[model samples]
Target chain A: MDLRDPALYAPAGHGDAAVLLALRDPATGALAFPRTPYGIGASGTPAEAAEPVELSGRATLLVCVTVHQPLSPGMQVPLVVARLRLEEGLVIDGVLEGTEEPPPGSAMQAVLVMQGERRACRFRLVGGAA
Target chain B: MSGLASMRPVRVVGIGMHPYQFPSETPYVHLGLTALRGALADAGLAWPDITFAAIGTGAIGMAAGRVMLRHLGSTGLEVVQVENASASGSSAFRTACLMVASGQHEIALALGVDKFGSAQRAANKDGVPRLTPEAEIPAVKFAMMARAWRDRFGLTREDLARVAVKNHGNAARNPYAQFRKPRTLEQVLAANPVAGDLTSLQCTPRGDGAAAAIVASEEAIRRHGLDRRRAVRVLSSVSSSEHQVADEGWSLVEMVQRSGLAALEAAGLGMAEIDIIELHDAFTIEEIVYAEALGLCPLGEGAAQLRAGQWDIGGGRCAVNPSGGLLGMGHPIGPTGIGQVTEIVRQLRGEAEGRHHPGARTALAHMIGLGSVAVGHVLQRD
Candidate 1:
């Protein structure tokens, strides 16, 4: 897949327009620019047919990503996040929504939490305030 | 700690908070005064009627109590400012409660105001003192401490994941909470580690907020015609710090253990007698460490009890942070202490909806601050 193929990396769904948003349970350490382990390539990298996005995959995670809005205390999206999981639940630092930027200089991260196997719900972060 | 008023019992006549968020063009004094007004309104009393004011804030960032209260109009009463790190406001509130409960004053007000939490604070160029070194803010220093604890206990990252999961679940139910949503272990463990294993999520977010509680005496309660259902009295209050810089006996466990003993004894109660508990879970691991220190469970035995659903809202013995805590809930220094008390008050009255603690009559509000300071308050309906 080409790196700049617009179709593969279109902003997936809810919270796609903003650069930062609130992360609820999946805690991102920083309050500002809170990251996520649930987003996929939104605008840069094209998803391949043979390789599925997983959270437990043991390797560098470099992909284009986008969201509907910045993560915030009361925000959630629809099937917008694409999580890449590697083995052993070994979550690489660079793999989180690590800031919604493009790939190739994305500073690779190891991730063990991939999107679940349920459509829409399969790859979405469902959330509400406690 | 005894009086005729104490025998008759008392209740929270007022409650207040500076909205939990970054300050708008709104001045800190404005926020503080707003909460003062809110507390007075809640207590159904007039400002002229408030006999005493015990206010708290931090540093000299605007005279904390004095400047903030000036905005509330003129009051020719003695005003004392309390600056106890994060626990500043609650300590002051505790003072007011004790005064009213002891029949010292009929109508008293407790104010907690922090305008600098969300906004940056003025740096002390003369090299101001800090709980930790200049290079280590709270998250970094505590993360280092947590790593040390893990190494000592032989605990894995997976073991700590449960803390985030449990707290987030409880936070999801608190409306006044800064963060009120549930989280997953995977998500928590995966978040950015501010320092070592402490992820950004595990650290409390800084926000701006205030909480105020109006304390009234039984005579004042009768004078003001306040209701009983909303009445909750101070049971026990303890204020102490980590045994200062002791090489041989320095332990957070002992500091908390001694403080808990004093507070419980003052209230004539025990850990098992508490129906609801509100702890300072600023960091995910702090919950576990303090649970043991407070004698809720044996040291290192917290994880087992926590995993057993023993501390659920309706469980016989419940430890909670219905305001999302500092984890899922936001942390705005001064008001946080009063905020904790506010939650316990709600719990005692069975007023919580989304995260109700059924039939809760007694509750504990406890917090630990930098400099190893701790304050525990016991409140009961009887």
Candidate 2:
């Protein structure tokens, strides 16, 4: 299956779960998401000194909101966007699985789903964890 | 790192604007020149009197200063273009103030002008791929902020809509505002929903316009015989960018708080001494959140203040965004910040006409740009 953004995540070779690609600063133990080539900004560690790591794709939903209109190009209406705190202590924004806004502090995990012709990463509430 | 106060005093002797309006076929040169001419006329000075010009623009390409100023006849004045996203105008004004205060130039001009739809963001060109590009949209991002505020502070949708109501009403009386019609709470709430609880009326309208401010040293003011009573003294200028915070979502708020406090401290005044504030209100929630961040009220008390009419013009405490702010006055990127200064100067001079806030002797102008930067200035009468 083709992933929407191959640099961000990859299949975990099980169910629908995926592992998030990230970079960790060796000195300060800081984490940066999406694995940019420019290296970690917090510690000023060069890209070569930064170590690649995979996040558990598990997070606690910090906040969520539903976009009622197609504000961006090629955006679908009623999209759910949320800020989540990863278990590794990094915060990131992602698309939620449902149209409804989940209450803050809900448990969520990354899952790969079909978006048009390509598979994309979306966050779903952990079962019985709301 | 001495503040403006530590240097020679700089005062704003003239301010002018070409009313913000919807995108039109009118050339940007016309918009910019109109503002320059107006400022010169208001200052009772000729174009040659301006020894330095700082052009603030977001979309207009290279050498914008020379291209626009050449029509006024070249006098070999120093020209530089400043671009700091929405705070471009504020940055330009700060540059002009510094030049005058440093004695590098006796007279300086800060002019901001821009049109809609042509500006671009550097984040897109950084080559970083995102998992959710839609989250980058400002309205969506701010919607998430509104939701977070609602969850943490129990902010109601009506509480957010009331900001639009007040600013829109203020705009109704402002001749230069893009949104000149007053909107009721119902009208605001019923407006087209753009994101989450944020309606279209709660967002700043995209348009084109221009604003200019002229700053001069006391020596120049006296030599030129400028009216000292009309001059508004610039007490302090402060600029800063976002810092890493525990809550990444509130980084912008942290920047505003730090910059605002620094500005007031540099000016040797407290929040109580500030009778007027013109801040970046591109969205309704910003006015509430930023005001609280700037120490206008404690956290979770902004809505209550708005409810009590404390933030209203002439309603007491301090009038926030008396020029209608970006929500009603329109955000033309570069021009918005200088326009804020123009409004504050007008109010301080008792010349805001229909929208004047009585006894507005001291004012603060705060602006935030795309780089997550904040710029603040404190101005006072006499």
Top-TM-score structure, candidate number: 2
Query: Interface RMSD value for candidate 2, one decimal?
Result: 1.1
True contacts kept of each: 0.00, 0.77
Give the Å shift of residue B122 in candidate 2.
Answer: 0.7
Model 2 chain A scores worst on lDDT over the 10 consecutive residues at A121-130
TM-scores for every predicted model: 0.68, 0.99
- Error in Å for residue B105 of model 2: 0.2
Q: Second chain of candidate 1: TM-score?
A: 0.88
Collision pairs in model 2: none
- Candidate 1 residue lDDT tens string, B19-106: 5664445666777777778778767788888877877666436456766666666677667777787778778877787667666678
Report model 1's chain A TM-score. 0.21
Worst 10 residues of 2 chain B by lDDT: B244-253
lDDT score, residue B352, model 1? 72
Docking class of 2: medium
TM, chain A, every candidate: 0.21, 0.95
